[model samples]
Target: MDIVQTQDLRKRYGKVDRVCDLSLHVPEKKVYGFLGPNGAGKTTTLKMILGLIHPSDGGVTLFGQPMDGKNRLSLLRDVGSLIESPSYYGHLTGLENMVVAARMRGLGMAEIDEALGAVRLSEAKDRRVREYSLGMKQRLGLAIAILGRPKLLILDEPTNGLDPAGIQEIRELIISLPIRYGMTVLISSHLLSEIDQMADVVGVINEGQLIFEDKLSALHALSQQALAIRTTDNHAAGELLTAAKVAWQRSEDYLLLNRLRDDNVARLSQILVAKGIGLLRIEERQSSLEDIFLRITGGAVSL
Candidate 1:
């Protein structure tokens, strides 16, 4: 079942279109990765869904209810979000900050320990927010967000400034949320690799337009397979490939062919040998999520 749906969702600032005609469906109890490059309007679209900002046109539905001005307040009670930077009192301790959040959300103090433990911040509860590392701060933010145990958790660029270990920690935590707490997640990130690891469903946006939205497995299956061939005489091999009408491209040290099958590879090898064009190496290459993202977004490689 879809817990969130949007139809022709659009957001504009002055003459600039931040997001345009985006339609999305987020399944229940799944991690939905909102993938895009910087300034692709990912944050804007997220804000619209959270009702933090209104769409210029179109609409959003959460939990089968229309997300308009009337129902936004009540609807937001079931949503927990951590957008951009996580806010905290610099002078307050980790536990102290969580206590503040708990008070604001009408949550019990026991939830403070539970949230901190979930993010593995229990040991650092007494540490001042100013002294915590970037990763710690992020974890604290996540703890605060999940304090009330909302059904939907929306995190925007949650792992933006973390180290490798930190990123992995957060990735594992996000992936575990749906299983452990039955929460549906909508996470936005520019990093394809990160989304590739954590998302069950992926929605890719470019220039404010959602270019692709589907299951992660479906996205993987869309990637094209190619064979890279290195020959002693690449020029001759190119000529032969052109004559045979094979779809191929010349790289710095290899020729990449798109339509190469197992039998075709053998035939090409034979043809190269027959023509005295020495075949050095031939290897099959599968496109990665990064490759697919770059291709779909017209080489937007910022992430």
Candidate 2:
């Protein structure tokens, strides 16, 4: 079942269109990635879903009910969100902060401890939030988010301040949250690799519009051939590629190609050998999510 649904959902800030005719369907107990560059309206769309802001046009529904009016509060009772940044009183200890939050929602001490343990911050639960590192603070924030045992988890850049280990820990925690607890997750980030690794489904937005939306596996299957070629003579290899009419680009070590008209290895070897350019290596593999992003976004280097 789709726990979250948006049909032509739109939001505007005066003359600027923050989200443009966007539509999305997120399955229950699934990890969905909302990806885009800065100012791409990803956060705006999320806010609309949470009913923190009103939509200018179209509609948003959560848990099969329209998100607005009196029902919004009850709808959000099962939902948790951390938009942009997680805020906590600097003077309050981590555990104290969570305690305050839990009390507001009538949660118990057991729930607070569980949340702390899940983020692996149980040892430092007594430390003042102001003294914690950026990574630790991020984890604490996440702990607060899950304190309610929420069915829907919406995290915006949850891994922003985490270290390598912290990031991996959060990644594993997110993947497990849905499976182990039956929670539905919707996370937004500009990092494609992070989303590629964690998400079961992906929706990419740009300039206030969704460019692509599909299952993670289905989107990766859209492209096939991954070409790898390296040569001793970079300049000569360029000339040889020009003559063969093969589409290729020079990476750090290899010339990456896609959709070639002929056997790139055989044709490249022959041409390079004829031109006295040594063919180092040629390998073919499956395309990655990064390759798909570049292909679809016209090498839209994230700003």
User: Which candidate wins on TM-score?
Assistant: 1
lDDT of 2 by residue, 15-109 (tens): 98899999999999999999887778888999899888999999988999887787889899999888889889989999999999999899999
- How accurate locally is residue 303 in candidate 2, as Cα lDDT from 0 to 100? 25
lDDT of 1 at 272: 94
lDDT (Cα, tens digit) per residue for candidate 1, span 138-168: 9999999899788999999999989999999
| C-alpha lDDT of residue 270 in model 2 | 85
lDDT of 1 at 9: 96
Tell me the lDDT of model 2 at 216.
94
Please report the TM-score between candidate 2 and the true structure.
Answer: 0.84
Query: How high is each candidate's TM-score?
Result: 0.93, 0.84
Error of 1 at 134 (Å): 1.7
